[model samples]
Target chain A: MAKKRIVTTTLNGNQTEFLCEPRQTLLEVLRDNMDLTGTKEGCSNGNCGACTVILNGRPVDSCLVLAVEAEGATVRTIEGVATAAGLDPIQKAFLEGAALQCGICTPGFIMQSEWFLSQNPKPTEDEIRFNLAGNLCRCTGYDKIVRAVQDAATTWQDHYMKNCHEKGCH
Target chain B: MRDFEYEAPTTLAAAIELVAKHNGSARCLAGGTDLIDQVRVGRLTPDVLIDVKKIAELNVLEHGATGLRLGAAVPCYQVYGHCGIVSDYAALADSCRIIGGVQIQSRASVGGNLCNSGPAADSTPSLIVLGAVAVIAGPKGRREVAVEDFCTGPGKNVLQPSELLVELKFPARAANSGSHYRRFIPRNEMDIAVVGVGASVVLNDAKDKFVSARIALGAVAPTPLFAKAVGDALAGQPINDETIAKAATAARAIAVPIDDMRGTKEFRLHITGVLTERVLKAAVARARGEHVDCRIGH
Candidate 1:
């Protein structure tokens, strides 16, 4: 058998390393090897954004990426969305808006939304719908989810501008 | 997906050697969006997965005196995000944005799309109309294939097992020329194109007549087609609804669509005409300096 290689990456703002086979995807490494189960796996393929992660500032379906490809790259999962202080503004908005139901898709939604809102800051409803189309939510019917992202766009800009000052929340 | 030995060679010579060593058992990994999916579904099972992104030649995206040289591994987001491509290669920009959502676009490369050779691929038709050339590298050296003639059938192309696509080369934009790509899908996003059309038009100085034109159709044949008949019909034609309609009819005649879950043969045939007309009008408007969103053809 071929030896497993260690992939070194700045994961969730910290330097992390793990040994993984080339066959294992970044999704499997994060969940099975690292035990960061916060990033759920809905569909193992790229169709569901359940394994969404920000790789070098762009959101990607981690399941589509090989674990070995994460070498020397930066990645952010749902675990990186919040600090020790409290829930992120987007998470608060999700809570207030009841944006989730079964919750399997929430992590992916949060990761995707955080990256998107950070990019747009204030996106139109159409833009939000268009951007978040990749992250599928079987529950909530998407009304509250869309509303939550809209609210985050409006509400997070103040907190974002005050703290990060255009460096971006993520 | 089955286990496969991985190799990431940083140089073109080294990558070619590895591929040649593995022969038909090796597959080059560009964006891996399509390749990975196909592997998971057992469509392809390679003994060696060669990561070609580390190769400097395959990652180059530059517009210089010669033309636009797009690395085979250049992702869709970068193609759509490029100012040069957005303004000059509008068809490519339009096609890139429609590949998948931002995540897929973030990782999916147009070269990978062409190499996948799917008839439903959204980027192939645009590449065809843009007069892009596929640069392939093998153990024997390199060769160039016109993008229009790249594909042989669904999920098949001209490249041999050891050959890797280095990049796509597009000629300098023609004067007074504009291009656009659009597709019809069941939904707005995250769906394969049911019918797609890409059109580029070079208008006369007054912008009232067609100096020349190129049209390509997707999901309507065994491979994406360069609509030679349509382009020939539009050359020297007056820019009008009738001319566009005539081009549309010609496009439909050249299309050999098949029935599928995405659309019926009749439905695809009708859409071929409808999209051809719409895309040509959009291209004409762009040639006249109109701000047509690459996404407007939806």
Candidate 2:
């Protein structure tokens, strides 16, 4: 067998490092090696979005990515989206909008929605539907999920601008 | 899965050497969407994986007199958004756009899709219609093959074990020429095609008669099939509803769809008729320098 390789990256926001087998997937490293089980695995294939995570500012399936490919990159999972104080505004909106029934597909939806809102502060229903096509939610049927995204977009924009204003980011 | 050594080569020559040295026990890795799955399922057991993603020369999309040159590592998402290619060859762009979702598109490479050699591959028809050519390099140096003849059967290609599909070359349409692609799927997104049709047409100066035509069909044969009879039906003729209907009939007659979970043979043949008619009309409209208001969703 080949020697295990070291993979260095910023996880959530903190700098972290680990030694992983060359064949180890990002999903396996996160769940097994790092004990970050928040990143769930629904299907080993890329079909289910349950293993979605942000890699270098873009959302990708953790189950499909090799750990070595993520070297010198930044990663954010469902647990990373929140702060020490409370949930991210998107999560809060999901709570307010009741976007979860079984809650299995919620994390992936939230991560995807966060990435979507970053790209377009405000997106039309069609745009949201198209962008979120990667994610599948059986219990919600995407009605409440769509509403949650819209609600989160509005609220997050307001909150972001307010923070920028207070910090004089003009 | 068996343990394997991984090498990220910086140059195409280095990649080729690694592939050559490892020979039968080696495989080139690009996006890893398919490669990783096959490895996990115990379908492929390689002693070494040569990741070509680091080779800068294998990631370009260039246009030239011979044709459009797409490097092996160029991601599908990159191809889909390239305005130059999309405006000139929407068939290729449309094929890239509908391959899986954003994540898959971002990670899937055109070369990987072709090398995987699945019968239902969405990009095959687009390349077939554009008269695309495959550029392959190996221990024996390089050679080119028309995309139509690249594959021999399911999950099998004519590529040698030491060879890599380095790039794809497709001719740009001349004046009064245009190409269009259409596919039928059960869902609006994240679904494979039941049947896909791509057609290119060259119109005479008067825009009343077709000077030449080429039609390609996918998912109905072991490899992407060229409907030469259908192309013959439309060539040197004015494209009217009646002419298009005749071409559609010819296309259906040439196709041989198989029964599968995604579609029955009858349904695939039926949809092939509908899509061929739709794309042929769209190609004619494009050849006349008119914009197509794409009505189909997903």
Best by lDDT: 1
lDDT (C-alpha) at residue A51 in model 1: 89
Two-chain DockQ for model 1: 0.71
The Cα local distance difference test for each model comes to: 0.90, 0.84
Judged by TM-score, which candidate is best? 1
RMSD of each: 1.6, 3.1
Across A73-120, the per-residue lDDT of candidate 2 in tens digits comes to 899999898898899998998999999998888888899888777767
Report the C-alpha lDDT of model 1 over B7-26, residue by residue, as the tens digit: 89999999999998998998
**How far in Å is the alpha carbon of B86 misplaced in model 1?**
0.2
Clashes of 1: 0
User: Residue by residue across B1-298, what tens digits does model 2's lDDT show?
Assistant: 5688888899889988888888779888888888988888889999888889888767979875666888888888788778767777778887888887777777888888889888888888888888889989888899999988998998899898888888888886688888888788888878888998999888999999988988999898887788877897787887798999888888888889899999999998898899999998888888898887653461
Q: Show where candidate 1 strays beyond 4 Å.
A: A161-170, B294-298
- Model 1: lDDT equals 0.90
Q: Candidate 1, residue A38: CA error in Å?
A: 0.9
